[model samples]
Target: MATPILAQPDVDSGLRPVPVTNRNGVLEILRMRRDPFSFADEKRLRFGEVSGMNALGIRMVTCSGPEAANEILMNKDRAFANAPAWSYFIGPFFNRGVMLLDFDEHRHHRHILQQAFTPKVLKGYMDEMQPMIAERMTRFPTGKVLMLSEFKQLTLDVALEVFLGLELPKPEADRLNKAFIETVRAGVAFVRKPVPGGRWWKGVRSRKILEDFFYEHIPAKRAEQTPDLFSVLCHAESDDGDRFTDEDVVNHMIFVLMAAHDTSTITMSQMAYHMAKHPEWQQRAREESLALGEHLTYDDLASMEAIDLIMKESLRMCPPVPAQPRMAIKDTQVQGFFIPKGTMVVVPQMANHRRRDIFSHPDMFDPERFSADRAEDKAHRMAWMPFGGGVHKCIGLYFGQMEIKTIMHHLLRGYEWSVPADYVMPMDYSALPVPKDKLPVTMRRR
Candidate 1:
């Protein structure tokens, strides 16, 4: 038998770059800030499949569709790195967060972090989460309400209680929430500096406050064994006896807390948008929640299939992290496109989610597509990567899901809500995707 020769990549040539007339990404940023979906769709059409653009002083090769996203996210060849690329946007603010680590360091950190999210620990979190969600649901005012703002506060409170073991006073919690908001907003700032009253300035100050807060609490957490995540981080060790330093604990805590609450808030708001828009799904989910009980057990969460499918649909429509950024550590090929070393690459999940080839009626709000009968998500492994994929996939995904479902479960049982028939949610993607107007709904007791 004769051995076949492998074709060599044309490293001398570069990607088919997208023509960008906007210097410094001013026009691109305006388009993305205006309507990210439209901007992505336009890119897909203009660039065909693989293309490059220079934005914010970064030269990025944007890979569209599931195949390219799978190639970049799965990291099969090890040619891409996450940290260096993410640092361009968020490194200064969320420096050394696990998502900003790559290769062995990422694996090491993730191993130590996994101890905090074990099955038993997650159950305890759910146990605490149930009552908090129920209590929060009970307080939602009847009639018109902004569900996004309400959900944001509710999720932040849950995160503080379950993750940090803190029952902050209303004023303190609000202050911390604002701090997180500023820190997150900093990732999208064009100036990337601490000019007075600017996003970067606010974020720098917020990072200091969060650092002080976590550092102050580290000593207390280390002195005792508590079920909270902060306590777990203070004590968690890898199988090899690797553990976090004081700075490591503080850095990880700040990142995890922001990830937990902010992403969960966005997901819940999307869930509310879908539930309120489609009353049939709402009724089905409400029945499931009511039948189970007022408080959800860990097992109950698994069996809530209707809510699960709705959650999947919501994520498919509006993934919290819409785009994944990575840098080419070495020369590579993505779908026959030559990617040179040091080029920033974006795998746009929001664009991939709308690919007509993968999803039937891609823009429609059809939860049944995720049902076992349809199993549309099975079309491609990368088709619905809201939580991302491979080694760097989100560790807290299950907890986030539990938190969102727990809140939705309580909301469904306690209230019936609806948006106007003609309503369309105006999504703002300044940082994470959120309803711009906070998702107004006509909420009332059941």
Candidate 2:
């Protein structure tokens, strides 16, 4: 009988093997789930760029640093697939999302999705968001509050209005928000089955809430033209005449809304934390926002250089999606390592973002490192890829950035927030890196 390649326990000629200490894949998986950034950093320091483990009987290869990231993400040979790998973890919930499609199909879906995010469309989204942001800011709680929680609700509301064109009452809105939360948190469940009462179970149940709503509204959206993305997508078609089906619209909306709202929440809350820890930077950013007045335009966002720098640094320190995964569709070598077919290849985004060789004083919260004189991110094209890179890069990147900046502009003008000088955000690494405590800050009206 032929031996399975990964079970051979020997490194192929010119191909590096997983460290001998990494024999227990279950332990490795647990350690990674507990502290992914630490696990990746330790592996890179001890094993260099490429490493792997046979976790729960699956051969998983993990790579660190921008060079490894470039090879896998670039995927010039089309030798790796995004859908199969992502489907294993998040596919049941976010099935058929742009992030889950690959090759020609991915290109096709992306082409159609692009029409909904054109500069003009994005400008419309911004205009829609401005008044909503202002009205919502009027309700922001004062004094000590859980910042991550606040930001989460803020971004979700923005997503519901701008992306879905829904204006539900408080209770209905809250119900949908709860469903989305369950749906997202369920993706990282260690248990994969629909066991009753499990995370996966709840996720499956909540997915119906979102699906039924979108499916019900598709007809109306298709019949009318509105500024909201839901309406635009219904009427949007590729130049080649390809249009999204009802299923495609629902899948893309569920996935895109999750990506937009959740990532923005993490980025905004972390930026606030970074500012609290370093008030001088906060003051600098606030000054820029103040100069722009009560409400700022999307184009005006770029002129607030300090806010942009702070936002970039925050994303660098803690990207919303810390790691991206791909599976080898066929036997492939990424930077001299032989990746066998079916091996799950993982890209460690945060580990590379914090590599000392890549960013000097990588642990510090110095936004100036990204300034013109330094440009540390220029060290490598993929060094600070918070939104990722390649054709599979985030399709809503600009709109998401615009939304985050708009929210920041309002928060800066409406309130002043802080935490203890020596405090640090103790983060949860289970799904996304969120503060375990939900991040508390002493927020006061400015």
Candidate whose TM-score is highest: 2
lDDT of 1 at 97: 93
What would the per-residue lDDT of candidate 1 be over residues 1-446, giving only the tens digit for each residue? 32211123454665432333333466777787688778888766765777666677777777888888889989999999999998888887788999999999999999999988889999999888788778877888899989988888888889899999989899889989999999999989989989999999999999998999898888999999988999999999888888899999988998999999899989888888988888999999999998998867998888999999999999999899989999999978788777778888888887788888999999999999999999999999999999998898999999999888888888899899998899999978878898889999998998
The TM-scores, one per candidate, come to 0.95, 0.96
Worst 10 residues of 1 by lDDT: 1-10
Q: Which residue segments of model 2 deviate by more than 4 Å? A: 1-23
Model 1 regions more than 4 Å off: 1-24
lDDT by residue for model 2 over 1-446, one digit each (tens)?
32134423235466643433435777787888787767877777667677777775467887778888899999999899999998887888888999999988999998999998999899899899999998899889998899988998898889889998888788877878888888888977777789999999999998888899899999999998889989888888888787899999999998998889889999998899998999998899888888888877878967988988998999998899988899999877878777878889888887778888888888899899989999999998889999888989999889988988898888888899999878889988788889999999999998
Q: After superposition, how far is residue 219 of candidate 1 from its true place, in Å?
A: 0.7
Q: Model 1 clash pairs?
A: none
On a 0 to 1 TM-score scale, where does candidate 1 land against the true structure? Answer: 0.95
